[model samples]
Target: MNLSFKKPSVDTCSKCDRINMKLKYAFVDQATNLKTLKEHQEAFKAAYEEKKANKQLAQSSEVVAVITFDLQQCLPTTYLQTNVAFYKRQLWTFNLTIHDLKTNKAFCYMWPECEGNRGANDIASCLYDFIINQLPNLHPNAKKLIMFSDSCFGQNKNSIVTTMLMLVTRLSPQLQFIEHKFLVPGHTHMEADTDHALIERIYTCQEIGTN
Candidate 1:
């Protein structure tokens, strides 16, 4: 008699479940109020469901890798003063977060701008770097790519971004198709927004000094 062996299954998380330590700290303040706690719970549940859905879709080997990205308007280092003799021009911080649905991870990149420029080319450069260099290693099995961004003409919704995406398909035989989608001008709630919220929370706390 011949016996066949099958390996025992090991459970693995579809995505990293590590909560941001800073975000958790912020949540502690919200937990103090009953109404705020309820709101937080609802938002948390919605976010979890979204992540779970993305994970399930990505399990299929042939699934297209969805890249959702957005450029945040540069933030000033310090709060603006109404009447200051110094006339300090605030330093700018450029932020972008690309969330890959296949990996269920958001890769954040921040650039401090001494040159004071945040144009379409700047956004394109960061995105192209990810597609050409980082994405292959992140999701090698990907066959198609879909990108989502807000309809900001100066940054994402212009011809330059469209042209770059077309060029990306030619970079690899494995990437057969690429498409870009714009969320309606008003309604966009994705991973990138969550990242921005975290940053804002940290910034606000720093500005107000946590009691």
Candidate 2:
């Protein structure tokens, strides 16, 4: 058979779903909405393709670095299967992974609920600190830094993170250009996800202790 079955994705794009729903009904006008859907999906595909191309470029060139970053789902500290321990208060652990396509390295920043809440400030700070430490190590010719992440406004798309990126570019002499882009919402599975999976597997072996 020429045709293959593609199962519906678990992560459905909200914008696509809304447009699809409208297209399903005869009453709703489809002209402009259909065009919008076409453009949106095309943009999504283009972004993914551009990231892939940039990754290849980064691997070969010293001037460019492509980094994909994402926050792992909160893991509860003192995790226990026992019925008594399940109800007890457990500190939430937050982890943010910044994976460089050029070096194939994942830098993780972690903190428990006691020290800080996982917010824009904390995320921006972690990224800024990482860049500061690693800036000296970057190649003398390095100039461009490309970043990929999901469009979670609170974490990635907000002004705080944007300002941090701006500050980094201004402060670092070698690093001049920084481009932060969001992946298609539903298709944002990234290298950072692998880090989360590995951490989760290890975390299950023993409880992750408090901060």
Clashing pairs in 2: none
Tens digits of lDDT, candidate 1, 94-143: 88889887766778777889754567887887888888888888778778
TM-score of 2: 0.82
What ranges in model 2 sit over 4 Å off? 1-10, 20-34, 138-140, 205-211
Stretches of candidate 1 off by over 4 Å are 1-56, 78-87, 206-211
Listed in order, each prediction's TM-score against the native is: 0.65, 0.82
Candidate maximizing TM-score: 2
